[model samples]
Target: MNKKNLRNFLFTNTFFIVLFLGILMVISLFISSNILFKNIYDSTIQNSVHSISELYNENMKYFEYFSSKYQDIVSEILDELYKNYINNIPFSSNLTIENFRKIGIFKNVDYYIINKNGIIIETSYDKDLGLNLANRVPNYWKKLNEELNKNNKYIEGISYEIKTNNPRIYGYLRMEDGNIFEIGILIDERAIPNFPKTVSSLNLNFIKSIYTYNISFIPYSFEFPLLDEEDKNIFNSLEISKGEIKTYTLRENSNGKESYVYIKWVPDKVNNKEFNFTVLTKISIDLSSIVILKNSIIFIFIVLIFFVIFSLALYLNYMTNRIEKPIMKLINNIESGKVDADAETNILEIDTLIKYYSHLVNTLVEKLKEEERDYLELKEKLQMIEKEKDLLYEMALKDDLTKLFNKKGSVQIIQKLVLNKESFSVIYLDIDNYNNILEKLGQNEANDAILSLVEIMKTIFRDRDFIFRVDENEFLILLRFVNLSIAQKILKRFVDALKKFNITSDKPYKISVSYGIIEYKGQNIEDLYNEARNKMEMMKMKKLELLKKLSDVNAEEN
Candidate 1:
C-alpha cells in the first residue's frame, strides 16, 4: 500500500483506539481524583474522631477525679453530722444544716443531703432545701441501691437535671447509720470547653468557632451558636449507641453566604451505659471553590494530552505517506510484469522499497526456471533472524531459571498498570524450605525441579497474567482486573500442581509452596506488597512447623 493508504488504514483501525484511550484517560483521572479525595476524607474523619474521643475521655476523667475528691469531703461532712448531731442527745436538724453549710464553704461544689425516705433534708444551695428528692432521684441511684442491697459498693456515673439551667453529676453515699446522704457536684463543663476549639483551629484557619456538648445531650458550652434549627433536628434524631461515632452536617452564614456545618459524635468510654456523650465540631468548606478548582485541573490535563497525541499522530501520518506512495507504484508495475521506467522518488525509504520490488520481480522470473527454491530460502532465513531478535529481547527481560519476567520487567509492567489505574491483584509466592531442598538434593536436581515447576506454572497461568521471579526462591504473579477469589483459585491450582510432582534424587521430596495474595483497590503498591509479604512469611512459618513435626515423627519411628 502507498503511504496515504497506510495512513488511512491506521486512522481507521485506531479510531476506536484513540477513542478508547481517551475514555481510559478520563476514567483514570477520575479514579485518581476519587482516591485522593477519599484519602483526604478518611484522614479528616479519623483525626476528628480521635481528637474528640480524647477530649471527651479527658473531660470525663477530670470530672470523675473531681467527683472522687468531692466524695472524700462528703464523707467528712456525713461523719460530722453523725458525731455532732445524730449520735448526740436531742439531735438538732438545724445544727446539721448549719454544719453542712459550713462544710460547703470551703468546697467548690454544690452539695445536698437526703434522708432515708428520700427527703432533701439539707443542701448547700438554698433553693434545693425541702424538695422531695424521691421524684428527682436519678435512675442510676435506683441501680446503685440494688447493688448496695446485694452488699456491693455503689460507684456509678449518674446524670440529673439540677435546678440551674444546666445538668449536674452527683456522687451519693448511703451512710451505715441508716441515713442516706448524697453529695452533688456541678460538673465544671467549662474546664475542657476549649478542646474542640483548639482542634478546629488546627489546619482550619477558615473555621470561625467550635462547639462541644456533654453526654447529657445538652449544649453545655460552645465557642459559637452550635445548634441552628436543622442541626438541632439532626441532633434530636441521632440514635447513638455506646462507643459509636456518627457524623452530621449543619449550615451557617459566613461573609453573607451560606456555609456548611460538620458535627461528629464520639464516645468517652466503650462500656459507658448512661450517657451517649459526644463532642460536636463544625467547619465550612467552600464547595463552589473546590468544584471550580477541580474542573480547572481536569480541563487543563485533557487539553494537554489531546494536543500531544494529536500532534504525534499527524507526524506519523506524514512519515508514512512519504514511504508508501512510491512502493505502491513499483508494486503495481511488477504485478503487470513490466518495470516502471519513469518511477522516481525523493524520499530514501520510498526509493529503496522500489529498488527492492524491481529486484524481487527479476528474481521471480529466474525463480520460475529454478522452482522458486532460492526465494523461499531467503524468506525463511529472514523469518529466522526476526524470531531470534524477538527471543533475545524476551531473554534480556526474563529470569533464566523460571522463564518468567525478571525484576525490571515486573516493575515496568506494574508501573504501566498503575498509570492506567485499573483494579488488579498481586500474589507473592515463596517455595518453603527451598534452601534446605537444594542442600539435600544438590544443585543439579534442584535445577531440574525448578524447570519442572516452571512448566507447571505456564500451564496454570493465563496468557494475560504476568508471572515474575522476584527473588531466588520467590515468584511474584500479577493478575490484572481480578478479585481475591480468582487469585486464590489460581494459587490453589498452583499448589495442586506442585503436589502432583515428585522429584527424587539423593532424598525423595514433595514440593511445598506458600503464597500471599492481595487484591488492590488504589492502595499504595509498596504497602500492598509489604502486606502480602508478611502474609507469605506467616504461611511459610506454618508450613515449616508442619514439616518439623513430620521429621520428628520419622526420627522417632527409626
Candidate 2:
C-alpha cells in the first residue's frame, strides 16, 4: 500500500525466515553431532572387540603347540586299539585299562571309552565311570559324534572334569565299533614354557589400554571355556547380517557414562579356514570423553551460529531500507506524464520497476507523440496556405508553370529539417539543352515538357519528399530517410524511365538530364545545396570530355 508498510511486511517475513533457518541449523548440528559420536563409539567398540578376539586366538596357539605333542601319543594308542578290534580280539580280555596304562605312550593319558549311546562305559579314571556325556554337555557330545564319523580324525577341546573340576586337554577319536575313544592329558603334564603367561599378561594390558571397563563372557546360558555349535550359529548369524563376525549394542552404564557391548565371534583357527566351532566374545567400552566433546560442540556452535544469524538479520533490514526509497519514487514518477529519460538513481531495482509497467509507459509516450503530430499537421497546413498566397501574388513560393516549390519555399523546408538534425538526401537535376528545345519547339510545347518532367518527379518520389524548381532548367529533390546510394538508385530509375519515354515520344528532340546527389552530413541546407551544384558541374564536365574523346576517335578512323 505504502513504502513503509511494504518495507515492514518484507522485514517481518525476512525475520521469520532467518529465525526458522537459525533454529533448523541448530537442530541439524546437534543431530549430526549425536550421529557422528554414536558412529565413533560403535567403531571404537568394534575395534576393541577385534583386538580382544585376536588375543584369544593368540593364546589358543600356545595351547595347540603344547597339546600337539601329546596328540601323537593318543593317535598311536588308537592305532593299537583299532588293530585289535579289526583282528576280532575282545577288548574285555586283551586290553584292560591297567594293561593299556602299561604301554609307555598311554601312561600319562587318561582315556574314556564312550559307547554308541554317549555313555562312558569304560575309563582310566574311576570318576568318569558310567557318566552320561550327552546329557551333561550336549554341545560337546555333538562334537564327539562328528569326530567318530570320520576315520582317525581328532579335535582338541579344553574341558574341566565333571565332578572334580580339574582342567584337562581332551581329544576324541572313533573306534572301529562306532564308539568314541576320548582321551585327556593333564595341563600340569604339558607346560607352555611361560609363553601363555606372557600372552595372557599382554592381553590384559591391551584390554586396559583400550578403555574397556568390564567384560563378561557368556555363551548361550552359562560361561563355558568351549567353542561350540551355538557360538558358531552366533558367528554365522553375525557374518550374514553384518558381513563380518562382529555386532554391538548400546546401553547406559551405571556410572553415568555411555557404554557399548560388542559381541564378536572368534574362530578356533585350527587350520586357518576349518573352524570346528566359534567363541562368542563380548567387550564393554566407555565413551565419556566422546559425550563431553559432543555436548561442547553443540553449545559452542549454537552460540556462534546464533550470533551469525543475528548479524544477517540486521544486514537484511539495512539493505531493505536502501532498496525501498528508490522504488517508491520511481513508481510515483511513472504514474505522472513526465519521465526523465536521463535521470540517475544508480539502483537497478528502480530502473527495473520503471520498465515493469511498460504498457502504461508506452501509452503515455504514444499520447505525447499524437499531440506533436497534430501540431505538425496544423503547421504544414498553415505553410501551404501561406505559400498559396505568395504564389497568387508574386509567384515566389511555388513555380508558376510546374506548381512545384520554388527556391524560397524549398529553402525554408530543407533548413527546418536540417536544424532538427534529420537524415535526408538531395539530388540536383539539370535538363540538358532545354533552351534549344524551347527555341525549336514553341512556348506551349516547352512548358508542356517542363510540366511532364515535374509530373515524372512527383510520381518517382514519396509524398514526404520535396521537389523544387530552383533555376530555369535545374530542379532539386529533398528525399527524407534516403542515403546517398539509395538516392543514386532512384536517379537510375528516373533515367531508365526517361529513356523509355524518349523512345516513344512524338517530340522532335529528346529530353535528357544531368544529375548529382549528396547526403546531408551535419551541414546547413545552403552548404549542402551548393555542394550538390558542384557535383552537378563535375558531371557535366565529365560528359563533355567523353564527347570530345568520341570525336577524336572518329577523326582518327577517317
Candidate of highest TM-score: 1
Candidate 2 lDDT, 269-294, residue by residue in tens: 45432223233343435467667777
Give the whole-model CA lDDT for all candidates, comma-separated.
0.62, 0.66
TM per candidate comes to 0.44, 0.40
Q: Write the per-residue lDDT of candidate 1 for residues 1-558, one digit (tens) a residue.
A: 635556566554565577578879978987886676556545554555555556555555544554454455555644554444345444444554455564342323454566766667876667888876456545534655665576423334424344332434444556675555555534334542334335555454223345555433345344445466676666556554333345555454554232555555544442333331245455454434444566678888888778867876786677667767767766776676665445643355577998999999999888796777877888899999999999998988888876778877887888889899877899888877678779998887677657766778888988888888878878888888889998887888887777666543233556677888999877776787788888899998888798899999999999
Query: Ten consecutive residues with minimal summed lDDT in candidate 1?
Result: 269-278
Per-candidate RMSD, Å: 17.4, 42.0
lDDT of the structure predicted as candidate 1: 0.62
The reply for model 1, stretches above 4 Å from the true place, is 1-4, 58-70, 78-107, 113-169, 173-181, 186-210, 215-217, 229-233, 236-292, 328-558
Residue ranges of candidate 2 with Cα displaced over 4 Å = 1-11, 52-69, 76-116, 120-131, 149-167, 172-181, 188-269, 272-278, 311-558
